[model samples]
Target chain A: MTGYTAKKAGYAIEYIALIAVVLIVWCVMAGRGTLNEIIMPAPSKVLDTVTELIGSGVLWTNLVISVVRVLKGYFIAVVLGVSLGILIGLSKHAERLSVLIIQIIKPIPPIAWIPLVILWFGIGESGKVFLIFLGSFFNILINVHDGIKQADEKYIEVSKSMETPFFKHIFRLIIPGAAPNIFTGLRIGLSSGWMCVVAAELVSSTTGLGYMIMNARQFGQTDVVIVGMLTIGIIGKLMDSLLRAVEKRAIKWNWSE
Target chain B: MEHKYIEIKGLSKIFTRKKESVHALENIDFSVDRGELVCILGPSGCGKSTLLRAICGLDTEHSGDVFIDGRKVIKPEKTRGMVFQEHRLFPWLTVEENVAFALNGVDKDTKAELVQQHIDLVGLTGFEKSYPRQLSGGMAQRAGIARALVNDPELLLLDEPFGALDTFTKMAMQKELKQIRKKSNTTMIMVTHDIDEAVFLADRIIVMSPRPGSIVKVIDVDLAEPRDRNSYEFLEIRKEVFNEF
Candidate 1:
């Protein structure tokens, strides 16, 4: 709670400074606002577009569609990544078998999967989710593996002395020990979730924040484009904050030292 | 006289590294009485810790039998509670939880009461919820001792339990240990290199020789209860154990 308050205080101060800078820039521009609205839109104009979209309920509809797809894809990615990472960590044979394949595949960016996802799943929800899953899986897997590898030897020895069951040892000690790293992976994966969803929408969707931006661009609605971009940023931040809250709860022992 | 609770007969351990054999312990035969507090003193790399580890059944490649209660120890169990040098309390758990961790598959009420009792036994009543990191060096060691004793094992194996502590803390711990032994009549075998620590705490100080280790001499401490370290008798015994090195 204290950390959140301190961060909020810092964000508020930054916003105040940002508003001051924008005001100075506005004065320098001196109302010579060109009708060339393709590249940049006025902040007030973007806000008005956001309000109009919200009032008409198109914003809610698009937001829900995008959020649902990202959630589904991101969760699948998290489960696969974490479980496979753990198996690889615990078993040397599994590690030797899969590490080379993972190294070869991880380099191919999630965006590059768009062509294949379209071919495999058609230009629909399935294609977009596959793209989002691809974006998140590798990062989460690597983090979980690293976290397990980094666990202290002494803790393992303690469990060994007690003769704790293999699964209990992993769940009770290894998982908790690797939690901070996994949380970091989740944060990164979730951001990738938004990017892949947006990219997917642009590639094949009729409705979504990405499609909203694309639709606005066709009509030269610069303010609506800015609104869609800002909404994406805000929603992405909310998901991250929610994950952080869960992380805090899980690793509450790490509150101070 | 009671038969020795622990009897090591020709115990030897040879470690093979790249086809080169290293002799860790060689032809060691030692015995301890049922109520004896025996502290083994030796130099670093002298296999003192290895001996303790072997007796605790963590080092299985070692030869010969380490008979505990006339039975060979093959693996660590609740029967022998060990207090390690570094106070290896689990970081995720508080003092109470760490102490009670080994008493699993028991009723909750019994576990809770035992946990609280042991926490109080080690003078950690107030620090029940404090994590290992939150504790001072001395306090953590005390918690470690408490954790070992909470099991109420037949043998308490201490591997340089207070070696990491400062001189003052070490003295205080020795005194606390004496009081605990007196109160409970617990059988303990501590491994330490400090001659003074051995003389001060042990009923019999088992002086161990350097590498390919073996018991050189067993100096009995015959001084009265609440031992006076400065007394002539204690000093004489200390000198005898020192000479065995």
Candidate 2:
């Protein structure tokens, strides 16, 4: 246990070391006026902008708005994607009917939908949520379908021999068996949703970190732009870590084996 | 004529892939008396596992009839339980949960009791909470057996239950299986490629040949309890079964 902890601490030190080096270089360059403040503000300037945003409640308000939008889209994607996946997975007819349509729509990037989204929903939250939904839905659907298909036939045979009830068979055997893959889809779908929300906000939204970054760019507040980018990176990482933690707990058997 | 506990008649299976048909089993017929332990011994690709699957109703594509307690088997039922070559335990479930998997309609206490009883029967008492990955191959197979027996099935079908184990573990498991059979008196039909395993556990051994698998011989083992593998009688029976191959 001690050795494991020491190894983990070593990795943490390495991660922080690289970031510290980059920050020191940036600070030195900006202090020496080698870098223009408009283009690349000093770390201190960005820190001040962060503090100012926080004091004025702009950071928290926009952060809440972005998070709520992501949650709405992600929730919808998960519900529809997993249900549709299960439907297609269990029925040969459903799979055959939907495969071609899903394939055609899946390849078109979520970014490509921005023009149509604007034409339909304008710059409202609905369009942004729809864009995020599109980004995440297919990833989850495809993965869940694959996961169900890949469940071992042997286990199914055992379930059959036991005469497990139809609903019980699906819930106890098939779902748990496909859980690892479903979790993979969920994690990937979440990240994709995060990316799409930012892109949508960038293209048309009046709020969110993406809009904050764009608005700062126009006003030449490079410090605020830098802060917005940093916020997105940190929050994205945090969300991923949260999901990973849940995945680790829920499927401990996968890790041990 | 006395009604057999289990019966198979004119069982045949053919697999067609891309217009090429492979005959797996041809005119296979057999039966097991109540509380009797029968082993179907054969070489690989001899349809021993296929026959076991057909008996358990896991393979209903076969053109034939299987009757257990005078009832035709159209699909798998709780009255018949099966253990496969691999343990096939649910990776997500603990030993206790896997044992209790097929059990429903019973009260929670009864369910727990049955799960506990079967776990102890298989000598997996302490590892009830442990997942399949945490157990060794033999232990996992033991859990599989417990799960199969939890339903208290009248007939237990095992297709190479210990085939994946090392020689020592296989021998030990065979002994445990014998003890289990003695205690439960459940009708067991085991399919095995190992000659010694058949000799060790089976009351009657049905030997088969590959390439349209057909029963070549049926040899009854009348050895006394705690039969010695190295004894002359055991060797004689082993030799007789081996010669048929």
DockQ of candidate model 1: 0.42
iRMSD for every model: 1.9, 0.8
Reference-based TM-score of each model = 0.86, 0.93
Who wins the DockQ comparison? 2
lDDT of 2 by residue, B20-84 (tens): 98889999988889999999999999988888888888779989899888888888888888888
lDDT of each: 0.84, 0.90
RMSD versus native structure for model 1: 3.9
A12 Cα displacement, candidate 2 (Å): 2.6
The numbered model that scores best in lDDT is 2
Model 1: per-residue Cα lDDT over B1-245, one tens digit each: 44578988888988788999878888888988887898988987778888988888877778898988888888877677788889988777789888887676779999999889888877888999998889999999999888888778778889999988899999999999988887678888999999999988988877788667777777888878778889998899888887775
Residue B160 alpha-carbon offset, candidate 1, angstroms: 1.9
Q: Report the lDDT tens digits of candidate 1 across residue range A153-204.
A: 8777666666667677888788888889889888898898787777888676
> Which lDDT tens digits does candidate 2 get at residues A1-257?
69999999999999899999999999999889999878888888889889999999998888888888888999999999999998898889999999999999999998899899989997788998998999999999999999989989989888888878889998998988989889989989998998886787965778888788889889988888888888888888898899999999998988864
